[model samples]
Target chain A: MSKKNALQTVPCESCPLRKLDTLREFDEDELAFVKTFKHGELTIGPGAPIVMEESNSPHLYTVLQGLAFRYKTLPDGRRQILNYAMPGDLVGLQSSVFDAMNHGVEALTDMLLCVFPRDRLWSLYTKRPSLAFDVTWLAAREEQLLDEHLLTVGRRTALERVAFVIWHLYRRGRSVGLVTANKIVLPLTQQHLADTLGLSLVHTNKTLKKLRATGCIAWADRVLEIRDQDKLLEIAQMEDTEEARRPFI
Target chain B: MSKKNALQTVPCESCPLRKLDTLREFDEDELAFVKTFKHGELTIGPGAPIVMEESNSPHLYTVLQGLAFRYKTLPDGRRQILNYAMPGDLVGLQSSVFDAMNHGVEALTDMLLCVFPRDRLWSLYTKRPSLAFDVTWLAAREEQLLDEHLLTVGRRTALERVAFVIWHLYRRGRSVGLVTANKIVLPLTQQHLADTLGLSLVHTNKTLKKLRATGCIAWADRVLEIRDQDKLLEIAQMEDTEEARRPFI
Candidate 1:
């Protein structure tokens, strides 16, 4: 990913994510600290590598726009997509905290990120208790997602797995206004969905077709439409875990 | 689980976990705050529930000794073991931060836990930046483990899946002196292993037998003997990821 050097800084007061209804509001002083905390903005195109596994970047990021995924590759070159990063999600806490990245991240769509230096994160903790709590909240929220995904990949049937992933993306997408009227432009290939589901390409295709035939979902040209959210949840045996108010940095 | 309420406080300065070489040392002031932060001790027998899914407890815990696992269950009564908790691993942090527990935790053996009030966690962060950093580090570390397990359960062959779990447990067990001479009195059943590997009981048993025949491992009664660490890692395609110095709170 190449950096766009001409800086068009978006001031904290005018930050787009802060305007989302689902996110909690930051107080004046907290927003002031965050304004200083942000290093700059980063822009990258679809499918560009954002962070490599086993390496640390000096910066952490918050997704200002677009989709990305965190993944890992086995020795045989098989990849497992761990989870997705959406608008307002923090992208690199593991690498920033431990000084070694255990997974790689790549842009799934044309993206913009607000960058923060890793070292200054400590100062945020010492100076702002509420924001520090928010940082831990984000990390804990991530763990909760991983725990749910592990359950899905490890025990759910093929049909159930496919349904769950779509249901999750739908809700997260709705929260950030990326989706509306049961539809979103999900920047993902069927192969990417296959990798995320732990299913082979042919099997994932069959499962997707089965769901579409049931009129629960439809996919074409990278757009995902949840035709029947209730039917999808029934197959997935899952419901919304989204909090009315969510935190983001 | 029954609470044995007679007071037997293990003071923070003389805490057993603090003496471990693998853990970083806390300073006098930090130690003083921890001593006050800790409410008391908790003891539970084997097979006891430590925390329940979808419910939040007022207190959070650290495993001072013994083994436990974090897991989730499907509506059909099928289960998936997400990951294990060892000495020095923080438990219930997700619930503490988010006020919702997404997974249940159970004791694999007789366990001793250090209890801290959930409300007090915020004070720790506000008062002590280093300890707050440790809290984030612990959370990040847990996420790292989940990422690795997702890769293993999602993509590894049955044999590799079995090897990876055993190798991972072996290394973590060794860290706190729970394992010795390549053997540990493991407190898990074949069904538990099956749940962990996301394989059927019969398939899991067959894979275990195959590994046994290769002289890489031996499991009789409740004892697990890793006869060949290198051979096991080769099959698992995993190596030790333990940091030379780690943090615990």
Candidate 2:
């Protein structure tokens, strides 16, 4: 059964995010205001680019469903994956405010995003300051995540790096209601993993083999199955970050 | 003459940032509101830790003068320098709103900061959404810088990484009125460079030697003299990012 077929456009009045345990609840007036802000929804398939570097975009998005990752390509053509944008994450926020994007975002799965005109962000700020704070909060949260990822890539050993990225993704996926118990069906391939971890494909494979040797994880096909979550966290030398109640539009 | 001695407290009514071309101007009312928000000033010497990880601090700061770097330390005590904070940049913003900081910031030189109570941020948001937008603008800018830094560390070659970081710091310093002609007096040492670039001290030294041999740059007694800025940019495969008029407080 294809899960994509199960998706439907839910009205903003009864947005599914309001029912999620991980997200904050908006008051009736706030909810009504946000409904008017929604211009429409966008659906893109896997491997599709959403925001390209230096391209002035007219709109920003909130991930309604599925996963995506932000990356930047060097002039010489080397690419580095910055971070993932799961459901409930705001996309192209920096560009919407600062200017054109310096990076790009690509969908990892069939993704749905709530669209908003970039120019109207000012009215949201003026009329709804609390919502504006949530926007800033989201930006700060992204900065915090990028800071942690930099630490992982620059300082962690290869074994630890692979473990860290997996654990990090699993935790983030769980927060956005994308996980099912110990399993996560991620859309990334080994090449994507190599680009993200700053390791060669062969080295990334070898590191994954080492993790498999520990009998704590199993990766076959697209599903990542964690047999022992605590052991994985132990190897990663970190705990899952606690997600506070955050607003989504 | 020490520039440190020339630094004196300037009232918000006639702040010098309005005169600088790189920073945005504030209207009279906005300036008056910011004046009331100012708690006091803090002075710290080089090598002092300002915002420590996990420390609950009641105040956030705007860099009135000098430079600082944000970093994270691994459990084994390895450190990764995230990015540098220059004059007019807000420090501890993530902590002030989101929670305790996940990273630490340290002074690279004698530093002065304008402090504001964290609790008053809400009032600022409610009363002055334009200023609030400016605050979010700063956070978004920081995120953009960190994203670029992550790409450099994770994807760029060792030589390119060295060129990129130096060029980036030079451009940022020039924007905040901290540079003179083609020279930037950085307060960081080569060890700091090693930590930031994810290289050993010896490798960082070797990389510096390579850059120095190219006749594009000179580093001695803590000052970086760019003999050929264009050459450095070419090697890094990046242009110096132009700063838009940005808010100070």
Candidate 3:
């Protein structure tokens, strides 16, 4: 990981993500405090650990660019990817609040992150409940995502689990402008899909091939193109998330 | 369903759960605000719906007594239980923060809930950052629980999942004074376990029977007795949660 103070680079006042129509707007007071709350920027290459399991970091992070994922490993080295992180998604919140990271985070792509000191996180709550609420809001959103993930893993058929993940990722990507012309750079290996879907690598491979045979989705060279969104959603047996302006830290 | 003004029964000033060693102590001012935030008391019998899936409720709730579980159903009626709500757990947090209950909450036993009108939720944030932080803390803790739940469902084998759930519940129940003499009255049916472990009823029965053959646990008539906690943990391959004074709303 490499880091330098991000003060000179795009200030929080002009942060591009804040301009997105999908995010709730922050008032000047909230924006000003957030600007000060930011410690600096850190950039890391793909496949680097952003946070370690059961450790503490001095900072909290918001993904300003690129994709990352949070995961936990078993004693035997089996891993389960909890969810992915993207721009506007705050990482290390468990560390910021409790000073411990219960799970590990790793970048899926070269990433830019806005960092905030954990020491002052309390002050943000005390001074601006609105922003504090945003923090809670973000946490609640993460919990909701996990609920969806649990459902897919626990109850869905293997094929349904694969379909739900792709559809879910597509919706998340499109909301963040990462999708273009029905395609997005997935940046995931079949092994990652296996970890995410709770399936064996061989099972994931066969399932993906079966889904591909239907021609609803095309995955090649890390690019996933949705050939038929309706068909994909139908097989996933899920609805797209409600289109609402979401809060972020 | 039943409703009565909790003000006349047990005010937030004397909330029993707040006095437990497992919960953090609140300042006088925070306690005072919580007293007003308490709208009333709600009581329901077993098999009651505390909150509905995809619906909105006017109030947020804290489980003051009894056990409840949150769940979501697939389009075909298959249910996946997300987690259980116990004492000090804010039940309607999704509703409290966003005015939406994305999952259904149901009582597994007679339940007592401390009500907080959702409309005043923001005012609490504005008035007390400490309390706001507590709310966020609770949300983060919930997220952590879900992460663990996801891991068990996604990675563990059938017998391992059953053992983990039992061990996990024992620890949670023990911490909250619900366990006695290595046993707790687990108000769960076999079907609930089936839903929770993502296994079929026949599979759940067989797995429980297999675990039982090891002489580590006994289940009869809604009561689960742990004959060997250490052996169960060994099979589950999970460490107990770090005993800490958790915050709550």
* lDDT per residue as tens, model 2, B1-249: 133323436777665556678888888788889987887778999999998977877889988788899999988899999999888889999887777898999998998888788999999999989899999999999998988888888998889889998999888888877789789898788899989988888999999999999999998998998899899999998986688878778
lDDT of 3: 0.88
RMSD of 2: 4.4
The collision pairs in model 2 are none
What would the per-residue lDDT of candidate 1 be over residues B1-249, giving only the tens digit for each residue?
123223646767788998789899998889988877888899999999999987888888999988999999988888999999999999999888877787999999999999988999989988988889889989988999999999999999999999999988888888887777889989899999999989999999999999999999999999999998889999998776675578988
Residue B20 error, candidate 1, Å: 1.1
Give per-residue lDDT, candidate 3, residue B169.
Answer: 82
Clashing pairs in 1: none
| Regions more than 4 Å wrong, model 1 | A1-6, B1-6
Model 3 chain A lowest lDDT segment of ten: A1-10
> Runs in model 2 with CA error above 4 Å?
A1-8, B1-8
TM-score of chain B of each: 0.95, 0.94, 0.95
Clashes of 2: 0
lDDT (Cα, 0-100) at A248 in candidate 1: 82
Sorted by lDDT (best first), the order is 1, 3, 2
lDDT-superior candidate, 1 or 3? 1
Chain A TM-score relative to the true structure, per candidate: 0.96, 0.94, 0.96
**Interface RMSD, per-candidate values to 1 decimal:** 0.8, 0.7, 0.7
